[model samples]
Target: MREFVFALEYEPGCNRVADALADHPDARIRSLSLHATDDRLWRVDHATGTSAALEDIEGAFLNGDYYADCLATDDCGATQTTRVLDRTDDTLVLYSTWERTPTCASVPHIARDHLGDGVLFETRHEGRHYTWRIVHSGVGDPAAFFDALEAAVGDCARMEMLRAATTEADAPTGDGTGGASGLAPEQEAALRAAVEHGYYESPREVDVGDLADHLDVPRSTLTYRLRRAEERLAKGYVADERFADAPSTPL
Candidate 1:
Protein backbone atom coordinates (compact mmCIF):
# COMPACT_ATOMS: atom_id res chain seq x y z
CA MET A 1 0.00 0.00 0.00
CA ARG A 2 1.07 3.61 -0.56
CA GLU A 3 1.35 6.09 2.31
CA PHE A 4 1.69 9.81 1.75
CA VAL A 5 2.57 12.54 4.25
CA PHE A 6 1.47 16.08 3.60
CA ALA A 7 2.11 19.38 5.35
CA LEU A 8 -0.90 21.67 5.03
CA GLU A 9 -0.90 25.39 5.84
CA TYR A 10 -4.00 27.32 6.89
CA GLU A 11 -4.77 31.02 7.22
CA PRO A 12 -4.87 32.48 10.75
CA GLY A 13 -7.81 34.80 10.19
CA CYS A 14 -10.03 31.87 9.28
CA ASN A 15 -9.58 30.09 12.61
CA ARG A 16 -10.35 31.57 16.05
CA VAL A 17 -7.72 29.72 18.13
CA ALA A 18 -5.20 30.27 15.37
CA ASP A 19 -5.96 34.01 15.44
CA ALA A 20 -5.58 34.17 19.24
CA LEU A 21 -2.26 32.34 19.07
CA ALA A 22 -1.05 34.70 16.35
CA ASP A 23 -1.72 37.61 18.68
CA HIS A 24 0.46 36.06 21.41
CA PRO A 25 4.06 35.99 20.26
CA ASP A 26 5.15 33.26 22.68
CA ALA A 27 1.96 31.22 22.61
CA ARG A 28 1.28 28.39 20.15
CA ILE A 29 -0.89 25.37 19.79
CA ARG A 30 1.63 22.52 19.61
CA SER A 31 -0.77 19.72 18.64
CA LEU A 32 -4.45 19.02 18.01
CA SER A 33 -6.63 15.95 17.49
CA LEU A 34 -10.32 15.64 16.68
CA HIS A 35 -12.69 12.73 17.33
CA ALA A 36 -16.30 12.33 16.35
CA THR A 37 -18.56 11.01 19.05
CA ASP A 38 -22.21 11.96 19.20
CA ASP A 39 -20.69 15.45 19.10
CA ARG A 40 -17.41 16.24 17.40
CA LEU A 41 -14.70 16.77 20.04
CA TRP A 42 -11.28 18.35 19.72
CA ARG A 43 -8.27 17.80 21.96
CA VAL A 44 -5.94 20.79 21.78
CA ASP A 45 -2.49 20.83 23.33
CA HIS A 46 -0.60 24.11 23.39
CA ALA A 47 2.41 25.87 24.90
CA THR A 48 2.81 29.48 25.97
CA GLY A 49 5.53 31.40 27.79
CA THR A 50 3.00 33.69 29.47
CA SER A 51 0.33 32.47 31.90
CA ALA A 52 -1.91 35.47 31.30
CA ALA A 53 -2.33 34.47 27.67
CA LEU A 54 -3.49 31.03 28.78
CA GLU A 55 -6.10 32.68 30.97
CA ASP A 56 -7.14 34.69 27.98
CA ILE A 57 -7.62 31.45 26.04
CA GLU A 58 -9.79 30.09 28.83
CA GLY A 59 -11.82 33.28 28.81
CA ALA A 60 -12.15 33.10 25.05
CA PHE A 61 -13.60 29.63 25.29
CA LEU A 62 -16.02 30.53 28.09
CA ASN A 63 -17.20 33.79 26.60
CA GLY A 64 -17.21 32.70 22.99
CA ASP A 65 -20.34 31.54 21.20
CA TYR A 66 -18.71 28.36 19.96
CA TYR A 67 -18.21 26.40 23.16
CA ALA A 68 -20.99 25.35 25.51
CA ASP A 69 -19.33 25.16 28.96
CA CYS A 70 -16.03 25.86 30.79
CA LEU A 71 -14.34 24.20 33.76
CA ALA A 72 -11.50 24.93 36.20
CA THR A 73 -7.86 24.06 35.61
CA ASP A 74 -6.58 20.71 36.77
CA ASP A 75 -3.05 19.27 37.02
CA CYS A 76 -3.15 18.65 33.27
CA GLY A 77 -4.98 21.87 32.17
CA ALA A 78 -8.68 22.66 32.40
CA THR A 79 -11.92 20.99 31.30
CA GLN A 80 -15.37 22.22 30.30
CA THR A 81 -18.34 19.95 30.97
CA THR A 82 -19.01 19.74 27.26
CA ARG A 83 -15.24 19.23 26.73
CA VAL A 84 -12.02 18.51 28.60
CA LEU A 85 -9.24 21.08 29.24
CA ASP A 86 -6.03 20.85 31.20
CA ARG A 87 -2.96 23.02 31.71
CA THR A 88 0.26 22.16 33.43
CA ASP A 89 1.86 25.51 34.07
CA ASP A 90 2.78 26.72 30.57
CA THR A 91 1.47 23.75 28.65
CA LEU A 92 -2.27 23.58 27.93
CA VAL A 93 -4.48 20.65 26.89
CA LEU A 94 -8.07 21.18 25.87
CA TYR A 95 -10.81 18.72 24.95
CA SER A 96 -13.79 20.50 23.47
CA THR A 97 -16.91 19.10 21.80
CA TRP A 98 -18.14 20.94 18.76
CA GLU A 99 -21.84 21.64 18.31
CA ARG A 100 -21.72 20.77 14.61
CA THR A 101 -19.49 19.00 12.13
CA PRO A 102 -16.71 20.95 10.44
CA THR A 103 -17.63 22.50 7.13
CA CYS A 104 -16.70 20.71 3.90
CA ALA A 105 -14.35 23.62 3.14
CA SER A 106 -12.13 22.73 6.10
CA VAL A 107 -8.91 21.17 4.78
CA PRO A 108 -8.69 18.49 7.43
CA HIS A 109 -12.32 17.66 7.05
CA ILE A 110 -11.87 17.34 3.31
CA ALA A 111 -8.89 15.05 3.78
CA ARG A 112 -10.87 12.90 6.16
CA ASP A 113 -13.69 12.54 3.67
CA HIS A 114 -11.41 11.70 0.75
CA LEU A 115 -8.89 9.40 2.47
CA GLY A 116 -11.57 7.40 4.34
CA ASP A 117 -9.00 6.47 7.01
CA GLY A 118 -6.23 9.00 7.32
CA VAL A 119 -3.96 9.88 10.23
CA LEU A 120 -3.30 13.38 11.54
CA PHE A 121 0.12 12.98 13.07
CA GLU A 122 0.74 16.53 14.23
CA THR A 123 -0.56 20.09 14.10
CA ARG A 124 1.24 23.31 15.07
CA HIS A 125 0.72 27.04 14.68
CA GLU A 126 3.70 29.08 13.55
CA GLY A 127 3.33 32.80 12.86
CA ARG A 128 0.47 33.29 10.38
CA HIS A 129 0.30 29.67 9.27
CA TYR A 130 -0.93 26.50 10.91
CA THR A 131 0.94 23.36 9.75
CA TRP A 132 -0.64 19.91 9.84
CA ARG A 133 0.96 16.52 9.19
CA ILE A 134 -1.59 14.25 7.59
CA VAL A 135 -0.93 10.74 6.30
CA HIS A 136 -3.24 8.52 4.34
CA SER A 137 -3.35 5.31 2.38
CA GLY A 138 -3.73 5.71 -1.35
CA VAL A 139 -7.20 4.90 -2.57
CA GLY A 140 -7.67 4.40 -6.32
CA ASP A 141 -5.87 7.63 -7.19
CA PRO A 142 -3.74 9.64 -4.75
CA ALA A 143 -3.81 12.62 -7.10
CA ALA A 144 -7.55 12.81 -6.67
CA PHE A 145 -7.06 13.34 -2.93
CA PHE A 146 -4.71 16.24 -3.55
CA ASP A 147 -7.09 17.78 -6.04
CA ALA A 148 -9.95 17.65 -3.55
CA LEU A 149 -7.74 19.08 -0.82
CA GLU A 150 -6.66 21.99 -3.02
CA ALA A 151 -10.22 22.73 -4.00
CA ALA A 152 -11.31 22.72 -0.34
CA VAL A 153 -8.54 25.04 0.84
CA GLY A 154 -8.65 27.30 -2.24
CA ASP A 155 -5.75 29.57 -3.31
CA CYS A 156 -4.92 30.90 0.17
CA ALA A 157 -3.21 27.74 1.50
CA ARG A 158 -0.16 25.70 0.53
CA MET A 159 0.32 21.93 0.62
CA GLU A 160 3.68 20.21 0.44
CA MET A 161 4.26 16.48 0.06
CA LEU A 162 6.86 15.45 2.62
CA ARG A 163 7.16 11.70 1.95
CA ALA A 164 5.56 8.96 -0.09
CA ALA A 165 6.47 5.30 0.28
CA THR A 166 5.01 1.83 -0.09
CA THR A 167 5.38 -0.89 2.50
CA GLU A 168 3.84 -4.28 3.16
CA ALA A 169 1.09 -4.26 5.74
CA ASP A 170 2.81 -7.07 7.66
CA ALA A 171 6.29 -5.59 7.53
CA PRO A 172 8.40 -6.27 10.60
CA THR A 173 8.50 -3.43 13.11
CA GLY A 174 11.06 -4.54 15.70
CA ASP A 175 13.95 -2.10 16.19
CA GLY A 176 13.07 -0.01 13.10
CA THR A 177 16.39 -1.04 11.56
CA GLY A 178 14.57 -1.24 8.22
CA GLY A 179 13.79 2.49 8.55
CA ALA A 180 16.05 5.49 7.88
CA SER A 181 18.15 6.12 11.00
CA GLY A 182 18.39 3.65 13.88
CA LEU A 183 18.80 6.41 16.44
CA ALA A 184 17.24 5.79 19.83
CA PRO A 185 13.91 7.32 20.74
CA GLU A 186 15.51 10.01 22.90
CA GLN A 187 17.93 10.96 20.11
CA GLU A 188 15.09 11.13 17.57
CA ALA A 189 13.04 13.34 19.88
CA ALA A 190 16.01 15.67 20.46
CA LEU A 191 16.73 16.01 16.75
CA ARG A 192 13.04 16.60 15.88
CA ALA A 193 12.68 19.16 18.69
CA ALA A 194 15.82 20.97 17.55
CA VAL A 195 14.57 21.29 13.99
CA GLU A 196 11.02 22.22 15.03
CA HIS A 197 12.28 24.90 17.42
CA GLY A 198 14.39 26.45 14.62
CA TYR A 199 17.75 25.65 16.18
CA TYR A 200 19.13 25.20 12.68
CA GLU A 201 17.70 28.48 11.37
CA SER A 202 20.26 31.05 10.27
CA PRO A 203 19.02 33.53 12.85
CA ARG A 204 18.41 30.69 15.32
CA GLU A 205 15.07 31.22 17.03
CA VAL A 206 16.29 29.10 19.95
CA ASP A 207 19.73 28.27 21.40
CA VAL A 208 20.96 25.18 23.19
CA GLY A 209 20.22 26.92 26.48
CA ASP A 210 16.62 27.46 25.48
CA LEU A 211 16.30 23.88 24.20
CA ALA A 212 17.83 22.54 27.40
CA ASP A 213 15.31 24.53 29.42
CA HIS A 214 12.45 23.27 27.25
CA LEU A 215 13.59 19.68 27.66
CA ASP A 216 14.28 20.24 31.36
CA VAL A 217 17.85 19.11 31.02
CA PRO A 218 21.20 20.66 31.86
CA ARG A 219 22.87 22.64 29.10
CA SER A 220 25.88 20.35 28.98
CA THR A 221 23.69 17.26 28.83
CA LEU A 222 21.64 18.64 25.98
CA THR A 223 24.80 19.53 24.08
CA TYR A 224 26.16 16.03 24.39
CA ARG A 225 22.88 14.44 23.32
CA LEU A 226 22.49 16.71 20.28
CA ARG A 227 26.07 16.16 19.17
CA ARG A 228 25.71 12.39 19.38
CA ALA A 229 22.37 12.44 17.64
CA GLU A 230 23.74 14.58 14.81
CA GLU A 231 26.65 12.23 14.35
CA ARG A 232 24.39 9.20 14.11
CA LEU A 233 22.08 10.92 11.62
CA ALA A 234 24.97 12.04 9.46
CA LYS A 235 26.43 8.55 9.38
CA GLY A 236 23.03 7.13 8.47
CA TYR A 237 22.68 9.58 5.59
CA VAL A 238 26.11 8.77 4.23
CA ALA A 239 25.52 5.01 4.45
CA ASP A 240 22.22 5.15 2.56
CA GLU A 241 22.39 6.18 -1.09
CA ARG A 242 18.57 6.31 -1.25
CA PHE A 243 18.81 9.68 0.49
CA ALA A 244 21.69 10.86 -1.70
CA ASP A 245 19.24 13.09 -3.59
CA ALA A 246 17.80 14.42 -0.35
CA PRO A 247 18.79 17.78 1.14
CA SER A 248 22.21 18.00 2.83
CA THR A 249 20.74 19.60 5.93
CA PRO A 250 20.72 17.29 8.98
CA LEU A 251 17.06 17.86 9.63
Candidate 2:
Protein backbone atom coordinates (compact mmCIF):
# COMPACT_ATOMS: atom_id res chain seq x y z
CA MET A 1 0.00 0.00 0.00
CA ARG A 2 1.13 3.52 -0.70
CA GLU A 3 0.84 6.33 1.85
CA PHE A 4 1.30 10.04 1.30
CA VAL A 5 1.52 12.71 4.00
CA PHE A 6 0.62 16.16 2.81
CA ALA A 7 0.62 19.56 4.45
CA LEU A 8 -2.05 21.74 2.92
CA GLU A 9 -2.43 25.45 3.53
CA TYR A 10 -5.66 27.16 2.65
CA GLU A 11 -6.47 30.78 2.04
CA PRO A 12 -8.35 32.17 5.02
CA GLY A 13 -11.00 33.75 2.82
CA CYS A 14 -11.69 30.45 1.09
CA ASN A 15 -12.53 28.58 4.30
CA ARG A 16 -15.15 30.13 6.58
CA VAL A 17 -14.10 28.47 9.84
CA ALA A 18 -10.40 29.04 9.21
CA ASP A 19 -11.07 32.63 8.24
CA ALA A 20 -13.09 33.23 11.39
CA LEU A 21 -10.41 31.73 13.59
CA ALA A 22 -7.76 33.82 11.90
CA ASP A 23 -9.81 36.89 12.63
CA HIS A 24 -9.49 36.24 16.35
CA PRO A 25 -5.85 36.99 17.13
CA ASP A 26 -5.67 34.55 20.04
CA ALA A 27 -7.92 31.72 18.83
CA ARG A 28 -6.71 28.53 17.15
CA ILE A 29 -7.92 25.08 16.19
CA ARG A 30 -5.43 22.60 17.65
CA SER A 31 -6.46 19.41 15.92
CA LEU A 32 -9.22 18.16 13.60
CA SER A 33 -10.35 14.88 12.10
CA LEU A 34 -12.83 14.06 9.32
CA HIS A 35 -13.98 10.45 9.45
CA ALA A 36 -14.08 8.31 6.31
CA THR A 37 -17.46 6.75 7.12
CA ASP A 38 -19.01 10.15 6.59
CA ASP A 39 -17.42 13.45 5.62
CA ARG A 40 -20.11 15.22 7.59
CA LEU A 41 -19.00 13.70 10.87
CA TRP A 42 -16.02 15.66 12.24
CA ARG A 43 -13.97 15.69 15.43
CA VAL A 44 -12.29 18.99 16.29
CA ASP A 45 -10.00 19.47 19.27
CA HIS A 46 -8.91 22.88 20.54
CA ALA A 47 -5.71 24.00 22.27
CA THR A 48 -5.93 25.19 25.88
CA GLY A 49 -2.92 27.53 25.94
CA THR A 50 -4.81 30.63 24.89
CA SER A 51 -6.72 32.99 27.16
CA ALA A 52 -9.09 33.88 24.34
CA ALA A 53 -12.70 33.89 25.48
CA LEU A 54 -14.70 30.74 24.83
CA GLU A 55 -17.27 32.89 23.09
CA ASP A 56 -14.58 34.13 20.74
CA ILE A 57 -13.93 30.58 19.63
CA GLU A 58 -17.64 29.73 19.61
CA GLY A 59 -18.48 32.82 17.59
CA ALA A 60 -16.18 31.59 14.84
CA PHE A 61 -18.33 28.50 14.43
CA LEU A 62 -21.68 30.17 15.04
CA ASN A 63 -21.04 32.94 12.54
CA GLY A 64 -19.06 30.85 10.06
CA ASP A 65 -22.36 29.95 8.30
CA TYR A 66 -21.38 26.29 8.31
CA TYR A 67 -22.30 24.50 11.54
CA ALA A 68 -26.02 24.15 12.25
CA ASP A 69 -26.00 23.91 16.05
CA CYS A 70 -23.94 24.02 19.26
CA LEU A 71 -24.37 20.65 20.92
CA ALA A 72 -22.37 21.13 24.13
CA THR A 73 -19.53 22.86 25.99
CA ASP A 74 -17.32 21.58 28.80
CA ASP A 75 -15.58 23.36 31.69
CA CYS A 76 -12.32 23.28 29.71
CA GLY A 77 -13.93 25.34 26.95
CA ALA A 78 -14.27 22.44 24.53
CA THR A 79 -17.54 22.66 22.62
CA GLN A 80 -19.59 20.34 20.42
CA THR A 81 -21.71 21.70 17.64
CA THR A 82 -23.62 20.24 14.72
CA ARG A 83 -21.93 21.95 11.81
CA VAL A 84 -18.49 22.57 13.38
CA LEU A 85 -16.59 21.64 16.53
CA ASP A 86 -13.66 22.17 21.37
CA ARG A 87 -11.13 21.84 24.85
CA THR A 88 -11.43 20.26 28.34
CA ASP A 89 -9.51 19.89 31.58
CA ASP A 90 -9.34 16.12 31.33
CA THR A 91 -9.97 15.77 27.56
CA LEU A 92 -13.26 16.04 25.70
CA VAL A 93 -14.59 14.20 22.71
CA LEU A 94 -16.93 16.17 20.47
CA TYR A 95 -18.60 14.94 17.32
CA SER A 96 -20.15 17.07 14.60
CA THR A 97 -21.83 16.38 11.28
CA TRP A 98 -21.39 18.63 8.29
CA GLU A 99 -23.78 19.22 5.43
CA ARG A 100 -22.19 19.82 2.07
CA THR A 101 -23.59 22.75 0.18
CA PRO A 102 -22.52 24.83 -2.77
CA THR A 103 -21.59 27.59 -0.35
CA CYS A 104 -19.54 25.43 2.01
CA ALA A 105 -15.89 25.03 1.04
CA SER A 106 -14.15 23.38 3.98
CA VAL A 107 -10.83 21.57 3.42
CA PRO A 108 -12.37 18.22 4.34
CA HIS A 109 -15.03 18.57 1.66
CA ILE A 110 -12.36 19.35 -0.90
CA ALA A 111 -10.13 16.45 0.18
CA ARG A 112 -13.07 14.04 0.23
CA ASP A 113 -14.05 15.06 -3.25
CA HIS A 114 -10.50 14.77 -4.60
CA LEU A 115 -8.14 12.61 -2.49
CA GLY A 116 -10.78 9.92 -1.80
CA ASP A 117 -10.14 7.79 1.32
CA GLY A 118 -7.56 10.17 2.73
CA VAL A 119 -7.36 10.51 6.53
CA LEU A 120 -6.95 13.95 8.09
CA PHE A 121 -4.66 13.36 11.03
CA GLU A 122 -4.17 16.96 12.07
CA THR A 123 -5.36 20.48 11.41
CA ARG A 124 -4.34 23.72 13.05
CA HIS A 125 -4.53 27.48 12.80
CA GLU A 126 -0.96 28.83 12.68
CA GLY A 127 -0.67 32.57 12.45
CA ARG A 128 -2.75 33.47 9.37
CA HIS A 129 -2.66 30.04 7.74
CA TYR A 130 -4.55 26.82 8.39
CA THR A 131 -2.26 23.79 8.02
CA TRP A 132 -3.70 20.32 7.49
CA ARG A 133 -1.84 17.02 7.75
CA ILE A 134 -3.49 14.33 5.68
CA VAL A 135 -2.49 10.77 4.93
CA HIS A 136 -3.83 9.33 1.71
CA SER A 137 -3.67 5.61 0.93
CA GLY A 138 -3.89 3.64 -2.32
CA VAL A 139 -2.48 6.60 -4.14
CA GLY A 140 -1.34 5.10 -7.44
CA ASP A 141 -0.34 8.47 -8.77
CA PRO A 142 0.45 11.26 -6.32
CA ALA A 143 0.86 13.74 -9.15
CA ALA A 144 -2.65 12.97 -10.31
CA PHE A 145 -3.94 13.47 -6.80
CA PHE A 146 -2.22 16.82 -6.61
CA ASP A 147 -3.73 17.85 -9.90
CA ALA A 148 -7.20 16.90 -8.76
CA LEU A 149 -6.72 18.67 -5.44
CA GLU A 150 -5.57 21.87 -7.11
CA ALA A 151 -8.52 21.81 -9.43
CA ALA A 152 -10.92 21.25 -6.59
CA VAL A 153 -9.43 23.97 -4.38
CA GLY A 154 -9.06 26.61 -7.14
CA ASP A 155 -5.70 27.67 -5.73
CA CYS A 156 -2.49 25.70 -6.12
CA ALA A 157 -0.43 27.92 -3.83
CA ARG A 158 -2.46 26.96 -0.77
CA MET A 159 -1.73 23.21 -1.15
CA GLU A 160 1.55 21.30 -1.17
CA MET A 161 2.73 17.72 -0.80
CA LEU A 162 5.04 17.34 2.18
CA ARG A 163 5.89 13.65 1.90
CA ALA A 164 4.71 10.55 -0.03
CA ALA A 165 5.78 6.95 -0.33
CA THR A 166 4.83 3.31 -0.89
CA THR A 167 6.09 0.83 1.69
CA GLU A 168 5.36 -2.11 3.97
CA ALA A 169 6.70 -0.44 7.11
CA ASP A 170 4.57 1.73 9.38
CA ALA A 171 5.41 5.45 9.46
CA PRO A 172 7.41 5.64 12.71
CA THR A 173 9.22 2.38 12.03
CA GLY A 174 10.27 3.31 8.51
CA ASP A 175 12.88 5.88 9.56
CA GLY A 176 14.16 3.77 12.46
CA THR A 177 13.77 6.82 14.71
CA GLY A 178 10.64 5.64 16.49
CA GLY A 179 7.89 7.80 14.92
CA ALA A 180 9.56 11.17 15.08
CA SER A 181 8.64 11.37 11.40
CA GLY A 182 5.03 11.72 12.45
CA LEU A 183 5.70 15.08 14.06
CA ALA A 184 4.75 18.13 12.04
CA PRO A 185 7.56 20.45 10.95
CA GLU A 186 6.55 23.23 13.31
CA GLN A 187 6.02 20.78 16.14
CA GLU A 188 9.45 19.25 15.76
CA ALA A 189 11.02 22.66 15.47
CA ALA A 190 9.26 23.83 18.62
CA LEU A 191 10.42 20.81 20.61
CA ARG A 192 13.98 21.16 19.39
CA ALA A 193 14.00 24.88 20.11
CA ALA A 194 12.68 24.27 23.60
CA VAL A 195 15.47 21.86 24.38
CA GLU A 196 18.15 24.07 22.88
CA HIS A 197 16.86 27.08 24.79
CA GLY A 198 16.99 25.17 28.10
CA TYR A 199 13.25 25.21 28.57
CA TYR A 200 13.50 21.61 29.74
CA GLU A 201 16.42 22.21 32.14
CA SER A 202 15.99 21.93 35.91
CA PRO A 203 16.40 25.69 36.18
CA ARG A 204 14.62 26.81 33.05
CA GLU A 205 16.80 29.24 31.16
CA VAL A 206 13.99 30.47 28.94
CA ASP A 207 10.42 31.28 29.86
CA VAL A 208 7.42 31.14 27.57
CA GLY A 209 7.70 34.85 26.93
CA ASP A 210 11.34 34.58 25.91
CA LEU A 211 10.65 31.59 23.73
CA ALA A 212 7.76 33.40 22.10
CA ASP A 213 9.99 36.34 21.32
CA HIS A 214 12.66 34.04 19.95
CA LEU A 215 10.11 32.29 17.76
CA ASP A 216 8.58 35.62 16.75
CA VAL A 217 5.08 34.54 17.77
CA PRO A 218 2.60 35.20 20.52
CA ARG A 219 3.21 33.46 23.88
CA SER A 220 -0.07 31.58 23.54
CA THR A 221 0.89 30.33 20.11
CA LEU A 222 4.27 29.11 21.33
CA THR A 223 2.73 27.43 24.35
CA TYR A 224 0.13 25.58 22.27
CA ARG A 225 2.70 24.46 19.73
CA LEU A 226 5.06 23.17 22.40
CA ARG A 227 2.26 21.36 24.22
CA ARG A 228 1.12 19.65 21.04
CA ALA A 229 4.65 18.70 20.05
CA GLU A 230 5.35 17.23 23.48
CA GLU A 231 2.15 15.18 23.44
CA ARG A 232 2.88 13.73 20.01
CA LEU A 233 6.48 12.96 20.96
CA ALA A 234 5.38 11.17 24.11
CA LYS A 235 2.77 9.15 22.22
CA GLY A 236 5.30 8.24 19.55
CA TYR A 237 7.76 7.11 22.19
CA VAL A 238 5.15 4.89 23.83
CA ALA A 239 4.16 3.32 20.50
CA ASP A 240 7.79 2.66 19.65
CA GLU A 241 8.39 1.01 23.00
CA ARG A 242 5.30 -1.15 22.61
CA PHE A 243 6.36 -2.33 19.18
CA ALA A 244 9.86 -3.05 20.39
CA ASP A 245 8.50 -5.24 23.18
CA ALA A 246 6.29 -7.23 20.82
CA PRO A 247 7.31 -10.83 20.10
CA SER A 248 9.27 -11.09 16.90
CA THR A 249 8.26 -13.30 13.99
CA PRO A 250 10.51 -16.36 13.43
CA LEU A 251 13.08 -15.77 10.73
Among all candidates shown, the one with the greatest TM-score: 2
TM-score of each: 0.50, 0.53
Q: What's the lDDT for all of these models?
A: 0.55, 0.54
* lDDT against true structure, model 1: 0.55
Candidate 1 structure, TM-score to reference: 0.50
Report how far off residue 101 is in candidate 2 (Å): 3.9
Tens digits of per-residue lDDT for model 1 on 84-176?
Answer: 366766866765554333231344445555666544446665433454545456565567767977765565455654445554463355333
Measured with C-alpha atoms, the lDDT of residue 128 in candidate 1 is: 39
Model 2 misplaced regions, further than 4 Å: 1-60, 67-95, 117-133, 140-182, 217-221, 243-251
lDDT of model 1 at residue 244?
A: 73
lDDT of 2: 0.54
